[model samples]
Target: MILINRLRTVLAVTAVIVAPSGGTVLAAPSVPAPVSAAAQPTAPITLRYEANRRSMLAAGIDRPDGDFLLFDPNGRGRVAQVFGDLSTARRIAVLVPGMTNRLANFWRGVGGKSYRSPAVQAADLQRAGAGSGGFAVIAWLGYDTPQGFDEAGRANLARAGAAELERFVAGLVAVRPRATIALLGHSYGSVVIGHAAPRLPPQVTDIAVFGSAGMGVDDVAGLGTGARVWAGQSDQDWVRWVPAARLFGLGHGAKPAGPGFGARVFATADVHDHDHYLSPGTDSLAALARIAGDLP
Candidate 1:
């Protein structure tokens, strides 16, 4: 029975990779060029935020509920919303989401659930770290994310996202040279972080992933980053059932939260499922906040 289940899992994952629509194979989209480091230092963070906000307004896009440092409505859409004043922040956290996210549901979430909304999750993290002082959080939807299980089973989208994420962090580091930064990713976002890790700047002090299937690597050393690595997975997460194996570029590889992956494991007992890791008052959120705020 166990062997039959394992085989079914493999076949199902393979089907997604080869023919996500059940009849047609889809080609990966072209990755955009990384943001140039030269362009970032030209403007302060505040100026950038205002300029993007103005652009969004002019484009007739509805006003964002909070400050946005970056916004583009083209294609699958991209945005980076800030939770606090970036200019005065000494510590910053960038939260990356997983599959099925786009501008259409960036604010309200997939089904209007606060826990799944990137903006709400960032706000929650910001509030969790409010006492830490000089802290800010950015809900970063800077890449074209995979829309379903078919794309999620592959690494092409993740590679493209990694390039974009690397550049976004570079811009942040350029603007706030002295600020400590943390990268937090959930689910397939963790795969993006795994690919971006080796290229990220030293100012990024930590990387945390929750409810992850894998980071597209064998272990922390495979990430090739000097920053500390953290992982969390609730027993209730369905991702635990995903095969932690990489085959023919199909799976994402070993789970980061599992033993032997070399990440500092954190408790997620309060998290009820994959989407609840960043929910308010969860132990996972508190731990992530501490990492982002540079608290012990």
Candidate 2:
């Protein structure tokens, strides 16, 4: 009976969150299903970096082999890093991760702990953007995110983080004057991006969201920035089921693949869950490349 109950819970969770888009979305699910065994939680990861105008490398840290600086901003494990073969790129991309996520999650390319993190996702976008031959990818893993089902009330952590993100962009602009940015946000990160959009400068070329709930907008103009807004969601993304009416109250909503939200709805063909967007050779990656590449 206990096993049956667990199965039921898993199904309920899956059905409530995953989308029904079918094969267009990668079938892999981001969250694990319920298990009978008690799951042990790991120590929460943390990090911080005191960013300054000029060079991130000047801050003093072991820079990754890639032509960018990688630093543990808070020394808690969270990372804030940037990537671009300056010799071959002119555009810059900023990637934001979701809940309970840290810096290490971005570079776990495929298997290791970092396999599906924003770093890995940014790398995928980097390669795709490389087709255009002049782009940089930034892994902005700074700020403290409310883990689990944290919502509004005592503190709007997402809103606060978005403001910090805006500052990061400003700092990046001051340092790399030639670089224009495309902010790519996933899951709860979309909320941060949405709230911060009102404060962004005109240099932001594109704003893209994947597996997002609602983006806190009634239309594109509400985004408050001139960047082209783009959205992509796998058919099986559970986030699609979060009703818009309930999203504002719960800090989530059902942002659909249609007009009015004011974004260019990309083709999510051959993709399925929230996390699959980082997978190499997927259509999602291809679309991301096209959009990022085409940005003026």
Best by lDDT: 1
Best by TM-score: 1
Work out the TM-score per prediction: 0.85, 0.70
**Candidate 1 Cα RMSD (Å):** 15.4
Worst 10 residues of 2 by lDDT: 38-47
Instruction: Give all candidates' CA lDDT scores.
Output: 0.83, 0.62
Candidate 1 residues lying further than 4 Å off, grouped into runs, are: 1-42
Predicted candidate 1 versus true structure: per-residue lDDT over 1-296, tens digit per residue: 88866766665444333321112323223222233211242356655655566557666778735577777777888888899878889999999999989988998997777668998999999989867478999999988899999899999999999998988888888778899899999999999999999999999989999999999999999999999999999999999999999998789999999899999999899888889988777889889888877887
Model 1 residue 157 CA deviation in Å: 0.9
lDDT of 2 by residue, 97-183 (tens): 776675434465323545466676777777777764777787777666656565531137677778778877776665556667788
lDDT score for residue 117 of model 2: 68
